[model samples]
Target: VLVASFAHFCSFDRCNSASSSSVLLNALPRPADPAPGHLQCPTCVTVFGSCPQNSDIVTCPNGTSHCYNGHIAIRGGGISSSMNIQGCVAKPSSFLLNHTQNIGVFTVMENRNQGDERGEDWNNPIIQAGAAPVSAPFLAWVVGLGLSLALWGGAPSLPVLYWSGPCPHWTS
Candidate 1:
C-alpha cells in the first residue's frame, strides 16, 4: 500500500494580494525500486532571474532520460517574471511547449545545452536534487485553487486525499 498526500495554502493580506504554499506527504510503504540505467543530470531553478551560474546533478526517476534547460514566463496580478529551470526529462522530443490557464498567464520553454555547447557533460557536481515531475491532476488542482484565491479574494480550504494499498483505482 502507498499513500501520497498534498496540501496547499493560499494567504491573502489586507493589500488584496494572494500567495500560495504547498506541502507534499509521501507515505510509501517502502522506497521505490530503482530504474535501470538511471542517469544523473544537471538541474537548477531560478525565479525572476537568468540561468543559474551552476547547476546540481540529479538522477532522473523512472521514465526520464534526457536533460532539459528552459524558462517559463509568468504574468499575474500585474506582475511578470521568468522562471529559469534545468532538469531531467522523460521525453525530449519537443524543443518547446506552451500552456496557459486562468491563474494569470505562463509559458514553459525548453532549451538543451544552453550554457555548454557540448550537451553531453555529466561529470558536473550536483548541488542539490531536482524537483520531481508533478502529476497533471495535481498541477490542475493547484492552478485552480490559485486562480480562485486570486479572483475571489478569500482563503479557501484545500481537500486532502488519503489512499492506502496498491495505487487506488481512479480515472484522471
Candidate 2:
C-alpha cells in the first residue's frame, strides 16, 4: 500500500510540475519579428502572383500589375482610372518559412501598355508560304467597277427605285 501511494504521489508531482512550466511558458513574450507595413492594392483583393520583385514588367498570371515596391500597384488599367485595390496580403518570405503579412493586390491600367509582352512580334512568321493574296479582294472590286462603268456608261442620274413594297391605297 505504501509503494502504491508513493507512485501516485510521484505522478501527481510530475503533473503539477508540467502545469507550472506551461503557465510560465505562456507568460513569456513571443519574439517580435519585423513585419511589413499594411499593404494596399489599387486594383483588387488578390495580387497577380508572387510578390513582384524590382521589375517594371511583371506579368502576374492573374493579370495584376506590380510596381517596384509591393505596397503600391495597379491592375487591369492605368492608375488614374482603375479600381481601388484592397486587402494587400504579405507574400511568403524568401526562405519559404515565415509570412509576416500580405501585400496588396496590384492593378494595371487599361491604357498603360508599357512593358506588355503581347506587343512583341517575335512568334509571328515573317513570310508564310501559300498565304492568301493580300490585294485580291481590292483587285476584284476595281475590275468589277470598271466593267460596270464601261457597259452602263456610268450610274443613272436619278436613284434606281425597286417597287417591292405593297402599292399605296388608290381611292376611286
Candidate 3:
C-alpha cells in the first residue's frame, strides 16, 4: 500500500512539472521575421521579338535579387524562333554575355547586371568579345610617369623595339 501511494505521488509530480515547463515554453516569445526589401527592376518578356519601347519597371518580390536580361534562339526540329527576356530574377543566368555562338538548337546569350558588377560594368569603355580589359591602375601609373618625364625634359634611353614580323629583307 505504501509503494502504491508513493508511485501515485511521483506520477502526479512528474505530470505537474511537465505541464509547468510546457507553460513556460508557450509564454516565451519567438524572433520576428525580417521585413522584405523594396528593390525595383525592369520587367519584360518577348517571344521571337524584342522588348517593347517602354518596358515596365517592377518591384522585385522577396527573395528575387537580380535583374535578368537574356536572349535565346531556337532553330531545329522545324522550329525557328527566338526569345528575349528582361525581369527581376532570383538568380542570374549562366549564358555568356555580349557574345554569340551556335549550340545545337539553342543560341543563348545573357546581358544582365547582377548588382555585383558596379565599378566593373562590361559596357563602360566597350570591350571585345574575348579580351581582358587593361588595368586602370597600370594605365594611370604609365600616364603619371610620362607626364613626369615630359616635365623634366627627359626621354627614355632604352631603344624602341619595333619588329612587327621577321625584318622583311632579312633571311634566316
Which candidate comes out best when scored by TM-score? 1
Local distance difference test, per candidate?
A: 0.39, 0.19, 0.33
Point out the worst 10-residue segment of candidate 1 by lDDT: 136-145
1 against 3, candidate with superior lDDT: 1
Ranking by lDDT: 1, 3, 2
- Which residue runs does candidate 3 get wrong by more than 4 Å? 1-37, 92-172
Candidate 2 has an lDDT of 0.19
Q: Which of 1 and 2 is the better model by lDDT?
A: 1
Using all chains and alpha carbons, the TM-scores for the candidates as numbered come to 0.46, 0.14, 0.35
* Candidate 3 residue-wise lDDT, 102-163, digit = tens: 43333434444344233213122223357453222110000000111111122221101111
Question: Candidate 2 — which residues are off by over 4 angstroms?
Answer: 1-16, 20-27, 30-36, 40-92, 95-172
Root-mean-square deviation of Cα positions for candidate 2 versus the true structure, in angstroms: 37.3
Better of 1 and 2 by TM-score: 1
The model with the greatest lDDT is: 1
lDDT digits (tens) for residues 1-172 of candidate 1: 1112333344644553334422232322334444533555555555566554445444555565556666655454444555455555555542423332333232223344453332335334222346562221110001111222332255542322232212212221
